[model samples]
Target: MKLFYEDVNLQTFQAKKTDEGTDQQGRRYVVLDHTAFYPTGGGQPHDTGLLNQARVYDVEEIDGTIRHYIEGTDPLLETVHGEIDWVRRFDHMQQHAGQHILSAAFENNFNLKTVSFHLGEEVCSIDLETDHVSEEVLKMAEEQANELVLENRPIETKWVSQEELQQYPLRKEVAVAGNIRLVIIPEADYNGCGGTHPTSTGQVGTIKILHTEKQRGQTRIYFVCGKRVNRQLGEKHDVLQSLTAKMSAPQEKLADAADRLLNQNKQLEKTVEELKNQLLTFEADQYQDSLVKAVFTDRPVAELQKLAKMIVEGNEEKIVLFVNETDEKLQLICGRSADSETDMNQLIKSVLPLINGRGGGKPDFAQGGGEKLMSAESLLEAWVKQL
Candidate 1:
């Protein structure tokens, strides 16, 4: 007997241990003649608790047999005392029932049907058969669902034969035809389902639609139910409080404060970049040699490219080779004036392998980085020899 299907609130039971074995992972498991534990199925996770002195971690129904994978107790015991983790089980019940109510709301009020559902660890999601769902649409569905919850309508489950199914207006067709199990909220939602649910809509507390995303031409709604709504509220409040303190703004003005700070940072970055380019151009104007070479400490390779480009552009027939060094690595950049036939790309390649580096570019410019096998001046001197 599956107590989960018959009595959703039944927390304890005594069952005969019919078989015991070790799986491929070496975890011990026992099959019982009867159990209250719910297996992992129908998008709902398995129930976990205790069997006598053992901790039941996972319960799975394989090939029509329920296996309660456990540890810490002797499997040889004939009669096992089982206890369900009511907290976990009841949370699942709340979320699952909320899903049905919310799904029905979208279908009945908006002509959108829920294609699928998932009861996650922190949130539940339902995929609707629509390309998009607007914020206003979500709010409408949420309000409708909560109204049903506030009404505290009775949630009834009935097992009916295929012939008797004609009397109830099922939201969807039954997957199995023989004994159809339906969870019904009278005048609200009637659907074929085997998952456990509470006795009334009030037990679900409230349904909150958190957000939505587009997936494969459908809209997936992410939400939390009952106590989870309060948990979500507390978590978000904590985040907002932390942000307000850091930004020195009141909760109501946090968004405006953040926007102003970001704009200030962007303006400062633009001014700094203009200053760097001016300094590089000034240094390039000081060099008069046709073959210009320089070495600097801890400069970025990107800046080296800027300095080399400036030098070549300022001189009619110049070839520039620049090197920068950090303690752990060396970087090089080579450039040439448009009038020069020198291949800066080939020139860098000739001595790059000596430092175990690899790079290539057009005939006029090239850049690369590698190990700091020598000083910045030594690297510059070596590249200058390639001229």
Candidate 2:
């Protein structure tokens, strides 16, 4: 096997085989020549390490070569020989193998291309170049893939001659003429894939298509198989337990409790609005007089504004004031009656200048806001004198 290294520090790179490879401070790293250790590529994360007879911490690829990142193995780095973690390696093989089976199944079922495939922590996903995946079709595809999984078909990988590659049907659209690697899962499917795979289909265990969604004009399928299914189930159980404690409800009654709370909140809002209307009506009656129709309130500014508009019938000589006692702001509006002699426009102009505010209107109506609640009683008395 040909190995390539650039700016290679052979001294800094260390090696060993251990489960928990490191102590507190430092660790070892193993650089391989043409490694079978799969570095993270094509959405699959890299493998963990085995150093000094323990499991190594992590495996990564730097510049196309596999590098084992060892933790506690540094002390034994000089004497210990490195080995790949085969259990984890085989698990990855099962997933990658299962992915090939499923990816081929999708391409065969829908004539859709697999754009990207990600083997994630809880689930593996295949992004297909189609916007929609109906439930019925998805179930059928899942059934077929599971059937193939049950068949326990032999999976073979080998480099084939260019002449031999022409005879077999390849799922990928691209063609390769030179040395080609093909993974053949007999009586099942074949594709141009560079990733590792299990020896047999049954090794994939049972695969479940958990969910799917449309993303970027494609259908992204979320799935789990083998040991991953158990992991996903364990995570879901833990989540439900946490929800039970956080919501302060038994597992079965949480949904009903949430629904009841939402309904009660809506009813409370309706009651609040009704009380506001009742208060507005009472406030309007207290401020009314024969020649002058007025509405004034020391409530929230928004509620005061709403009450002020409701008290006036847009007629008569009207003076409405809204005073927000908390925020210390006042709003005033004046309008003329049919027989009134007062100039409402001039009155607002004069009052606004005195209050350090700005307002204007025709002789019939004017409006403005200021911090003038202390002058409210005297201001109304003086303005009514003109009328």
Candidate 3:
């Protein structure tokens, strides 16, 4: 017998250790005649606690038998005291119960039915039948859900036959034929579920819709309940406090401040780029009419491309080859004037393998970067020899 099924609030009980076995993963587990530990099912996580002195890390129901997986292989007493982690169990109850209320609220206000539900560690979610859910509808549903929670309606569970199921207005049909269990909230919701839930709507504390996303033609609404709402608010507060100190802006003005900072950064970048082009033009003028070749230290590949293009454009007869060197790698940017015969595209490709590099461009201009196996000047000398 599953003690949790009888009463979810039963945190501790003594049950017979019926059998012992190892799962496919080689983890040793013990089965109990009756267990208060809830197994992983119905989108709810397993309950973890202690079976006597052995710490039960996982509880799984495989093939209708509940297994209490522990840390060591030591045998447990025939009759062991089972203690469920009531904090975790109660949290799951609150969340599961809250889901029922929120789903009913959507259905009542917008006629949107819940297609699927998932209870996660941080947040819970329910997939609505509709493809789109308007903000106004969500707001109305949320308001109604909270108002319902305040009513503290009794969350009742019942085991009924197939014929008796017809008495309740179920949100969806039960899958099983014989053993049917329904979770009901007075005038709110009635649905078949195996998950544990609190006895009253007030036990759920409060419901909060975190966000939503479109999934498989349905809108998945992510939400949280009870203590999780306080946790989320605390985490967001920490982030806001940090941003306020750095930006010197209040919470309300932070968004505007961020936009102003982004715009300022863009303008500064434009100014820097214009100044760099002027300096490169002066440097290009110094190169006399000849086949230009030079190596630079700590120079970016983009700057090398700009400098190479400028030099070749000034002297239509020149073919420019520029290389930038760092300790670990080297970048090369080469180009030719319109009248020059050499194809810079094909030339760069052939030598790229020599240094294990990758890049390409038009016939007149090309750029690449590769491992620095040799000195920059020696590498440029090798490139010049290729011409």
Candidate 4:
């Protein structure tokens, strides 16, 4: 009754509509007596296609029934023509087949067992039951997998009862009790799987291990197969070419060029910062003789603090009060020379009520910001009076 198992190549088929219903989300679905659509299971995604002019977005098996979720609310008739999206179906087949071959290679070469698998949109991954996988080990597994692809070994599936499992050399134990399905690559691998796959190892084309990392005490291997291998190569080549052109260097020399440019940028930044500090020092000298009470328009608070510190450091007799006025707020900074007996923290608290601001600091300096209830000049004058 499983059309996909009967023949994975059967993309088009005619089936009789068995039932129609709506799921909990109100999505309409139809059940067919026989369908070529492969339901989402065994780490493989469901097949998408069209059924009698209605777009079938998802196919899922629930309680031994295949439910095809359709796009529109179209009534199902007795007979309907169903067509699977062959491109997507074949891509999944290639990835699934590649996973099998790669898992077998890991086992045969390194004695690592595959514990889990995930078939993603851009890549597929298998979690191996090991704490670490070295680059040398990964390359060995990849090489062995490609060798199987070149061998063009036949991929066969068999239906057997639970008692007959002892006859085959299964890579892992089968979980289900009844109707166990076994996928076998002769002399290479035998495992329990229900996912669709190509008939031969060559149909998978190639297996490329992209990278690996440790996850949950297991080594997760990310890889691509068949056409995706070529796509990944093309993308990487384009990126390298762009980098070479932008850096004005050949691909081999790009890294050295980038390092040189980075060093130059760091030196330029240091030079600019030194010039800014020099200008601040020069400005602070102008207010060295008297108490400094100045207001700036839309200045950064850090700059105000820097100017206050510079004035206090330049004149031991002077106290500095700096304020900045912005669109919606006012900021204040107060600093005193170490010789000055004036407590800057007490001065800030006394003037904060006038501007509805809050601030705290030691006796030598303080800074804060709040609502702009008073003019910057008036706020600075008030602080000066307090001193």
Which numbered prediction scores highest in lDDT against the true structure? Answer: 4
Root-mean-square deviation (CA) per prediction = 2.9, 9.9, 2.6, 4.4
Candidate 3 on 143-178: residue-level lDDT in tens?
Answer: 899999999999999999999998999998787899
Positional deviation of residue 367's Cα in model 1 after best superposition, in angstroms: 3.2
lDDT of 1 by residue, 1-387 (tens): 798887889999999999899889998899999999999987888899999989899999988899999976554579889999999999999999999999999999999998899999999999999998888899999999999999999999999999998998778788898988889999989998888889999999989999899999999999999899999999999999999999999999999999999999999999999999999889889889998888888887778788888899846899888787888888888889999999878998988887899888899899887887877788787787777
Worst 10 residues of 4 by lDDT: 285-294
Q: By descending TM-score, how would the candidates be arranged?
A: 3, 1, 4, 2
TM-scores, all models, native as reference: 0.88, 0.58, 0.89, 0.79
lDDT of 4 by residue, 1-387 (tens): 689999999999999999999999998999999999999999999999999899999999999999999998657679999999999999999999999999999998789999999999899999999989999999999999999999999999999999899999999998898999999999999999999999999999999999989899999999999989998999989999999989999989988999999999999999998998999889987885668888899887887788889889846677888888999998888888989988888888998888788997989999877788878888888788887
> Highest TM-score, which number?
3
Q: Which 10 residues in a row give candidate 2 its minimum summed lDDT? A: 2-11
lDDT at 331 for candidate 4? 88
> How close to the true structure is residue 7 of candidate 1, measured as C-alpha lDDT?
83
Clashes of each: 0, 21, 0, 0
- Name every residue pair that clashes in candidate 3: none
- Show model 4 residue runs off by greater than 4 Å: 266-387
